[model samples]
Target: MPLDRRSLLLGSPFLLSGCVTSPATQRPSQAAISRPDMVEADYASIYAAVDGEPFPVPAIDLQEIEPEFLRRAVGYRTAERPGTVVVDPGERYAYLVGEGGRAIRYGIGVGKEEGFNFRGAATIARKAQWPRWTPTPDMIRREPQRYGRYAGGLAGGAGNPLGPRALYLYRDGRDTLYRLHGTVEPWTIGTMVSSGCIRLLNQDIMDLYRRVPVGSRVVVLGSGGGTAV
Candidate 1:
């Protein structure tokens, strides 16, 4: 069968073989060899399909995801206070600052180009569930054939690129147009492939949505620079 978005997202067994190299040619990374603190059953439950929303969210196939990219708690030492969101595009990780030198780290897919990524402090002034997505004017100009048709906007749903939730970023009381949202292409997590927004797995973004609220601070680090943007 041809690989559709859903098929690729679900990590169909037949598709999996072609997605990665054979064990004969390459060895698994240490991160992949060592499992997270959570067991198989725990991961299954954590990433299970979510209901009770405007639309159903399909479960993520862990096999399609990198082990390091899976959501997990880690010791993070940062001056930022709890509830702050620190996005490290260089590492492709978003850290939700927590108390006691710890954080809930979620792997993220970022802008493919450094120039396209947002680098600065902003506030989560608004949020939406299954939010509408409209390509920016620049996006339309750059790729008319790809984005011009959606200039008006695309309604939120399972098929939408902005998957399940979106945390809108604002600076100086104005919308920055940079968002932290979910993606239908869960396999893209941990890679730099988005236009500009940071994308999380549908399940992971929902978890973050429940944890964060409007008015939260968001700091996106400069590409390859540890300095706060």
Candidate 2:
């Protein structure tokens, strides 16, 4: 049986530690309100692809996801300026700080174990649509049987693991090799299952990619609650 929203929210440690309740009367910003698909969308409407999107993003079944993982407006009290993207891996949530005291929150899948320990500030140096995927040398060495086939690279497509979009992370002038990208398996949202990549639902990522520019700041907090950079 598929995991329901209530079951996952009640059972998942991330949700317990991560979710903060906001007053019902706080309204979303103009930008948030404009996205009816995100602000007030049902599962079916939320899952539908936006017109003229460069890549294919298949509609997803909302029942397959925990409700908390769905994109929504939240009262986020953060010092970070608006347009900054802060990822709390422990909470399995990504916050796009907005004007006022609110944020556009999106559910995400994070890396396992130490992969969650990645702490620091980086800039989104590049963005891609239907980006190609390549396994790192360490990834291939660790699991050659699983990754060797993609030793060269995998073309972007509906079946590509990177899904429809990718935001490359960089620090100083170097590529951190960490990415904020979409996933083919939306069911994996709110879980620890990636190789240090931050995973978002295809639809959610498309929205984020459009709003987040190449020079946007990305702060990934540490497990110890210390800010990275």
Candidate 3:
């Protein structure tokens, strides 16, 4: 069958291959590897689709999501060479510039005003599947009651706010402490709610996670936002 978004997002977690960590070592439980299906589920149940399945993306209501935010290929003209990631935060889109004046675009959720803007160049230093999350010291200090419990770290899982994948950004070989990662809340896409990380819908993040190579270049435009890979 011709590949569709559902197949790309819902068929195989290994669709791209070589990006996954050993399940035995990364997942907290077997259930995290294979879980239940999501059927006509509400937004709250979205996490059920991603909890621990080998193919963890769930079908979301496209009608509810803006068409521009959905992943698609488009004719794009840019000076940046192919394989570069360009993020336009003001417009809320991330583009993977491809060969021949084309680009793959995905809608993104950005950080709030405090974490909303940064300018400069960075590289994809690392990638992780279902990455562990630690509330930053700044985050804890700002909201202790909310972030204190997870200060040490939260294991990768559906319940973890980072969702199923993370691309760590680096500049000059130093960690930026920013990430482009999956979000448990699909509805959050195309919004600005996060502290500093760039968030994509879980399925979209997985799609992006597979395409981006380690050491890829990422450019955040104007006052926009993006992690790295």
Candidate topping lDDT: 1
Q: Against the true structure, what is every candidate's RMSD? A: 9.7, 9.1, 12.6
lDDT of 1 at 220: 94
What shift in Å separates residue 162 of candidate 1 from its native position after superposition? 0.5
Clashes of 1: 0
lDDT per residue for candidate 3 within 1-229, as digits (tens), equals 1112232233212201111101111212233212211112223332224444543556565566776687666777778878788877777788887777777777887755633455567899999987887755665565577557767777776566667788888889988777788766667678765655777877667767767789999887876343323
Error of 3 at 4 (Å): 31
Judged by lDDT against the true structure, how good is candidate 1?
Answer: 0.71
Show pairs that collide, candidate 2: none
TM-score-sorted candidate list, best first? 1, 2, 3
Clashes of each: 0, 0, 2
- Candidates, ranked, lDDT: 1, 2, 3
lDDT of model 1, residue 67: 90
